[model samples]
Target chain A: MPHRTEDIEIGLLLEALYQRYHYDFRHYARASIKRRLLQARSHFNMSSVTALQERVLHDPEMLPRLLGFLTVQVSEMFRDPSYFRALREQVLPHLRTYPSLKVWIAGCSAGEELYSMAILFREEGLLDRTLFYATDINPEALKAAEAGIYPMDRLRKFTENHQKSGGKSSLSDYYTADYGRAVFDKSLRNNVVFSDHSLVTDAVFAEMQLISCRNVMIYFDRGLQDRAVGLFKDSLTRHGFLGVGSKESLRFSRHASAFSEFVPEEKIYRKREP
Target chain B: MSAPPDRAVVIGASAGGVQALLALLPSLPADFPWPVLVVLHVPADRSNVLAGLFEAKCSLEVKEAEDKETVRPGVVYFAPSDYHLLIEENGDLALSSDEAINYSRPSIDVLFESAADAYGERLVGIILTGANNDGAAGLAAVAAAGGVALVQDPAAAYARTMPQAARQACNAALVLSLERIADYLKGLKAE
Candidate 1:
């Protein structure tokens, strides 16, 4: 079958993005990326993806805007509350034995999961000893995450999720509402480090006690998924916990044997002592 | 006229979806040649039991779709409750936590549009009984991509707004009742 003209245009666009900007999305899943690029094309009022690519390549300002479309930022605090609950009830006890803890929130878009983890650690009496690393490839998302503010409307659900995750304190204690926004307390991020990192291209930067990289891998193809999981395996300390999205699993990964299913239902795995 | 050799069939239903699916799906023979993907509006908070419910009654294997799983024939893949299910160009299934479209997560449009892109003219898209206009644009996309679009006859639907909206969106879509739609599907040959 002949390639659709739109698909050919998308390939050229992705190539242009790699050649002009250092951002690499070539290994990302094709169908969703194609949809996103088409959405971007429509938003820019361009006739096709090639036109969008031409504009992006010529105008440096368009790179960031186009990057926003290429990277998915959809996330919620305490998403799949059961996963957090499992961390609280089952995983925390194991982490508490360590003198100090380093937790990595890989692909931490808008810092929702990072904030969730910080709050969870604080409630569990582990925050003071914990240093959180929040990383993402999108600079806009990293900035938003560093600000730790969210729309006021989203707080109710966050609060409910926190409670459902067996949060030990009031969710209100962490954020102040102002001008239709919830400004999370700056103190919550006292030990947090926000950085620009890409699982697609960058190497692991730290040996972490817990790494929560949820829903980020679904965008990657099988080979990229293996690379990311291998990085997770290498970055984790022996017996460290790694949590992924509820629907994602290590069952198909080549690195699956390096970790044991710590909480099978929640998709939490523990690195084997090597 | 006989239907083209379809590589896959995608069905979208809501409002009275379960009953409609039960009536339509169980009629599929165990050796049905193409895969069937379904998107039925379900609440995000509750755990999905739709796959299990259908598996007990259907002849083909039925299960919730997983990320990166390869699409297989002779199976019915139901979109999970809170994630959008998409078909990759390589025919692997992908799940996205992207914001809901048309007020739905496992949105009918998301599935149909993606599948239309993946399979092109070798796809069959069907819109069953529903209350909202979610699947209308998706069926239009299918028709635009040269895939067959079939809408339940509004008069025969449990809720007419959905089918009526779909028919309006894709004027070329065949308007058929539940039994006729099933018969049409049964008549389809493997690619």
Candidate 2:
């Protein structure tokens, strides 16, 4: 099919999806969505995006299978060392005021970032006091997150991050590299409760001292971003901190007024009274 | 009959991406069977010219990723500036602002490693070039998770250090120069 027709088919398919599935992707930006659908058109061995959408609407199995292709998950353990450093240097002091801590790692695909937090808590002597809730909508990724088995070899690089993030101990002490993979110490993830939660469809469940929702808001539109931010603000205790991805900020959001910048460079913010 | 599952190719580039992407993307045949996901490290906050840069280069199709977008195999997926583009289990694109890794939100490691987890053996992870040791560990994870790992030849890469880092972490099942890598991908059902 010509490129123009392909794009047209994509729009129609999205409409069909909204009507049939009741999943509102209509508000999502177009170029990327169309690009993904166009790829799907060929991926499912269909002739066009419209045809691919048609199959998904009728075939129960197809939607879930196609759902697999639609998801683009990329993350690592201790991804941004600086954020952890900020948690240690600045946020920890403030967090110590509370008797116990509730830390949420939202959209924690496969749990790398959550485990990183676990390690940080353990090192900071906050692990016992910390109760982590790692949530994601992806079941497969969530299962992996619960398992806490990261590739053993990535430890070397994560080790560098650990060092740069002002790690106090040798990075190797945390995990044992066995079976050509790094099995992180089970003790670190003990307090972690990995579950399925959606920022698009879910609401606040608990009061948290720190909400580490990195890399999640970028998928949401401005409205959805605000909704999620509002939830974060609602969930956080006063003076609680929120850490977002560097590319993401609360600078212009509705909730922007509710927080003061903690380590602005590291994208850490503290929730203020609304 | 239903068409075959589109082969999805995710390309991770750094340091010399402008040249590498231009060279590699053009080599991919027009109407290739899978979408290509490209992550090239650029200075954060700058406009990533990749979409415009590679729009005409021998194209299956080229575009940047967006939040909550579904990903397909035939279209090429490029990481936008300063954001980590991830795959949801639903097989959709989820853009992230969590933080930077190796000083990059759209770090090659972030993309490759996640894609590795998402696609498993069906996935192919390619590390073209870069100065930092960003994608090496991720590529190793990809290979470990049963995805094929491709590294451009350090000798030929504009930035040999990045390729060498990747090569060190994994055996680098395939090491090729621009032309050879291009040929290898062209022969693939998906990249």
Candidate 3:
């Protein structure tokens, strides 16, 4: 089939973005990319994607603005309580045997999932022994994650989810609310590192015992999903754990055989020892 | 009016969707030609049984749309609850948990607009019984892309707001009764 006009324009745009900005969305699922690009076009007051591409090529400042559109930033603390509960009950027991641990929260948007894991580790008495790596392609989100502050209004739902995840103490214990912002204790960040990492272009930086890369691959095309899962396979220690979103699965991934279902209902998989 | 040839059907419903789906889907024969994709409003927290329920009633194979799965003819694919279903240019399915649009995660507009891009004139967008106006703008996108737009007649719908909204937004190619819509779908296979 011949490429649509918009499709051609988008192809060039993504190529230009990669060449100049080095942010690769070329292999992302096409429909969502098109949708987000169209949104970016309208937001920037451009008539067509071609015009937007021209501006993006010439103006470096437009990169972050467009990245804001391309990356999905919506997330919540302990978004799925059951997944965390399963982590605490099912996966934590296995990790307890390890003298020290590293947890990689891939695609850790705005620090919500990272904070959830951090709080969980602290509650389980594993925080001191654990090194947390929270990473994403979005620098803005990384900055936000490093800040560890959220608007006060979101605390109610966060508290409920934390409680549901078998939280050992009040959610309030981790944060102090003042002037409509909840500043999570700096102690939570003592062992955590926030960094800019692209699953598409970047390789495994460290071997990890637990990698929670939830909901990020839904935006990726099959080849890209395979690449990320392959990285996970390479990055995991022997019998390490991997958990994805409720709806995500390793069944279709090319690397499926590398992991077995640990908490099947929660989409959690464990690396199989050779 | 006949469905456009080589077209796919994208249907969206919210309140009273199950009854509407049952009334329409079960009537099609075993070898329905065009693939049917549906997005019914469901809570994020619960497991969706939409495919399972439809499988018992419809002769067509029913399953939830998986990420990057190619669109297959004669299959009925339900948008899994809490995910936006999109059709790629290559006619594969892609799922997104991006923020909800128009207060809906599986927003009819998202699916319809994306399908319009993929199928163009070879698409049929349908709005069924629902209490919300989620499908109106989506049906309009289908129409704008030279695809057919359909809506259940408000008076005949169990919940009319959705169809009424579609009527107000787009000049639908057909305002069909549930039985007529089923008959129309069946007629496509004859061609």
Candidate 4:
């Protein structure tokens, strides 16, 4: 299969990038890597992939731009209303048994998901006893996640999503509107520590009862996916739950037999009690 | 940044959706090349039978979207049946309390626009069966931004108004039958 030679050039460029910056995307799936390279081309307006790669490898500052292009960030608050619902109904009860809890929202891009989980924990009578670590590789997203400010107009929709996702009270109760922005309640962060971490190239930090990685694994190849799943498997406590995106599964995965279906329909799995 | 196109797929649904999705999703197999994001607008409440149903039907791993999560391929991420889903610049997920557009917070527009901004021409937006016209304008935005715009033939959609609105708003690439739409996506992976 002859891939566009431009793809070959981009592959070399990524290798060059790793050599210089030490960021390893060599394990990321080729399609996504190819896609990100294409996005970088347009951002720089080069004639072809080779030109784009040439310029990026030569210019040091351009690496950040390339990195941004590579990480096509997408996220939301309390995204799948039901996964949290399941946590609330099924998992939270057991979590409540602990005197305190350590939860990790791995690959938390801009922090909306962490905030959502925090809100859930707060409402579930666990916020005071909870400690959350929202980690991501993108520094820009980490800063925004730490700031916790979002477009004000989005609050109404989020409120609706919140209500529909089994939110116990008015969504308005979570944040205050100022001008055109919704500044989330500062209290939500009291227990949350937003930092920089990469599922691709970093080591796991803590054991957690719930690790909600959502859609972060799609960019990875089968090997990297298994590595991250292995990290999640290692990070989770006994019978802890691992939640992934709707289209992702443990089936046919290297880690497939490691977990059991808890809410298989929802993509929620419990680490097999080994 | 001079590379050929990299296509990504986005899907939106609402109202009588569980069944609609069950019918539509089983059509998408696992190992579909591009990443697909599903926004199903279920009223904010306890959601059930969604992730599970799709999990069983679709070969891809089907689960709800999470905040700040990056998009992944061969995976079908449904909007958490309540909240609106969006894309972040860093390629992570963005969940919001942002007010609803078209009367729904997890409005199809929110997902479509965010995805449009992120993926641009590489993005493929699909407005599936839904009661409201939430995804219509957003689908147009995707088309206008150089993304591929596809809608289930309104006549074939479980909810026709939304697809009709999409066709009216944009120069859609394909107005496909529900089952045919699946075939079209399969072709994308092959490409």
Candidate 5:
């Protein structure tokens, strides 16, 4: 099939972005990328994607604004309660056997999932021995994740999700409600590190006992998904756990041979002993 | 006359959609040549059993759309709950959990707009019973892209607001009852 003019322009834009700023979005699923670029185009008051790309290539400030559109930032605490329940009931027992633990929350948007995991660990009596890494490519999201605050309106759902995930203590134990914001307990951050990382371009940062990277790889193309899965395979210890979003699967990944479904319905996989 | 061989069918519905779909989807035969994509509003926490509900009744195969998967003819692909389904430039399916549009994750507008872009003139967009106006602008988009737009007659719909709103937004090519819509599809297959 011949490339449409707009598509060729998008290719050039992604190429320019990679060569100029080192953010590789070339392998993102094209449909979402096109939608986001169109959004960036309108937000910047540009007539077309080509104009937005030209502006972004020259204006350093445009990169961050466009990054907000290019990357998805939707997340909520314990977004899928069943998956958390599976983690708490099925995965935690095995994790408890480890003398120490390193947990990686890749694409940890706005710290919701990180705090969710931290609170879960605290309730499970594993917080003290666990080190957590919460990483994302969005600096604004990273800053928000570091702040650990969310609107009070969202807490009701979060609290309900926590209870459903088998919370041993009250959701109130993890945060104090301010005027309209819920400020998560700083103690939860004691063993946590927030960093900028990209699954698209960055290499594995550390060995992980459990890696939860949900709703991130759906935006990637097949080859990119394979690359991210390969990175996870390389980053995990033997028998280490990997949990993905409910809709994701390792069954089709090129690196599928290296892992087995640990919780099939929950989309959790465990690395095979090598 | 038969619809073009390259034509793709995109359908969107909300409240009372499952029943509406039951009345419409079972009519298409196993050898239907056009791929059908559906977006129905579902609760975020609920699992999508749309495929399961239709698989036994419909002649065409029904399954939840997967990320970046190629679409096949004679199949009915329902958007996975909590993910926005899109038609990619390469005529494949893509899913996203991006922030909701019109208070919906598997938004009708998102699917219809992308399908319009991908299929262009070779698209058939239909709106059925729904309470909200999520698919209104999207149906307009389909019409703007030179695709055929159809709507359920408001009097016959389980909920009238969606089709009424779409009627207000665009000049739909046909506004017919569920049975008539099924007959129209069967005619396309026969052609």
Candidate 6:
């Protein structure tokens, strides 16, 4: 069968992105990425992916706009309550034994998961001892995550999720809602270090007690996914926890043997000692 | 009869979807040549049991679609509740947690549009009983890609709005009852 011209254009565009900007999305899961690129093409009012590629290659301003589309940022605080609940009831007990803890929130899009973890830790009396490394490839997202503001309307769902995750404190204690925006408490992120990092192109930077890299790797192809899992295995301390998305699994990954399922239903794994 | 031998089928439904799927999917023979992908709107907060529910009834293999898994013939893949399922050009499955479209995360439009891009003319898109218009644009995309578009007849559908909107979106789509749609699929031959 003949290859689609659009697919060819997408390949060229991804290649241009990597060679020009060093943002490697060339190994992302193709279908969703293609859909996102098409959305970007339409958003830019470009006639085709080829035209979009040419424009982005020449104009530096267009790269960030395209990056916004390429990066998946849709997230909710305590998005999957059950996963948080599992972390609270099962994982935290093991983590509490350590005097100091480093938790890595990989792909911390807009700070939802990071904030959720902070609140969970605070409630569990682990806040002062824990340091969070919130990282993402998108600088814009990292900045927003650091700012820690969200629409006020979303708080209801967040509150419900908080309660479901066995929240001990009122969700209202964390943020001040005003004029359709909720500004989260600054102290919640006092120990957080937000930085620009890409699981696709970056290496492990810290030895973490818990690494929550949820939903981010769903966009990766198998090879990239394996690379990411391997990175997680390397970053995690022996018997430390690694939590993936509820739907994502390390079962088929080459690095699967490095971690054993800790809470299999919640997709939480424990790094095995070498 | 004019359908391509190496075709794939995508079906979208909501509201009365479970019953419609049970009635339709079990009719496929064990040796059915093409893979069947289905999306049904369900609550996002809970685990999806749709695959298990259908596995006992359907003759073909039934499982939830996993990210990056190769799409195989003779299997029925259901989109997980909280994620949108898409088909890659190489026929692998991809899942997305992007913002919901038409108030649904596992949006039928997402799946159908991606499948149309993947399979093009060798794809069959079906819209069944649903109260919402989520699949209208998707079925139109399928038709635009030269794929066969099938809509459950509004009069026969448990909920008529979805089929009505889909029919309006694609004038060329065949409007058949659930039974007739199954018969047409059963008539399809392997490549």
Model 6: docking quality category: medium
lDDT score at residue B1, model 5, on the 0-100 scale: 38
Residues B1-191, candidate 4, lDDT per residue (tens digit)? 32322446888776556666676677776677777788887766544457777787678888777654566767777776545677643465555443356788677887787677667777889877777788888899899878888888777667788777788888755788777777777778535
Q: After superposition, how far is residue A110 of candidate 4 from its true place, in Å?
A: 0.8
* iRMS, model 2 (angstroms): 8.2
State which candidate, 1 or 4, has the greater DockQ.
Answer: 1
Q: Where does candidate 6 chain A have its weakest 10-residue lDDT segment?
A: A1-10
* Candidate that beats the other on lDDT, 3 or 5, i.e. the better one: 3
- Model 1's chain A TM-score stands at 0.99
Quick one: best DockQ, which candidate? 6
Error of 6 at A242 (Å): 0.3
**Model 3's TM-score against the true structure:** 0.96
Badly placed stretches (over 4 Å) of model 2 are: A1-24, B1-191
Q: For candidate 5, write residues A15-105 as lDDT tens digits.
A: 9999999999999988889888987888779987789888999999989889989986788898898899999999999999999999999
> Across residues B69-95, which tens digit of lDDT does each residue of candidate 3 receive?
777888899998888999987777888
Q: Where's the lowest-lDDT run of ten residues in candidate 3 chain B?
A: B1-10
Cα distance off (Å), candidate 5, residue A148? 0.5
At residue A131, candidate 3 shows an lDDT of 97
Candidate 6, residues A1-274, lDDT tens digits: the string is: 5877998999999999999999999999988898899999999999999999999999999998999999957898998999999999999999999999999999998999999999999999999999999999998999999999999989999999999888998999999988999999999999999999999999989999999999999999999999999999999998999999988999879999888999999999999989
Cα lDDT for residue A210, model 6?
98
Report the number of clashing residue pairs per model.
Answer: 0, 37, 0, 62, 0, 0
Candidate 5 residue-wise lDDT at B107: 90
Candidate 2 lDDT, tens digit per residue, A174-264?
Answer: 7777788777778887788888777766888999999998766766666788888999999999889899986577865888999999899
Between which residue pairs do clashes occur in model 6?
none
Worst 10 residues of 6 chain B by lDDT: B1-10
Leading candidate by lDDT:
6
Q: Which is better, 3 or 4, measured by lDDT?
A: 3
RMSD of each: 2.6, 12.5, 2.8, 9.1, 2.6, 2.5
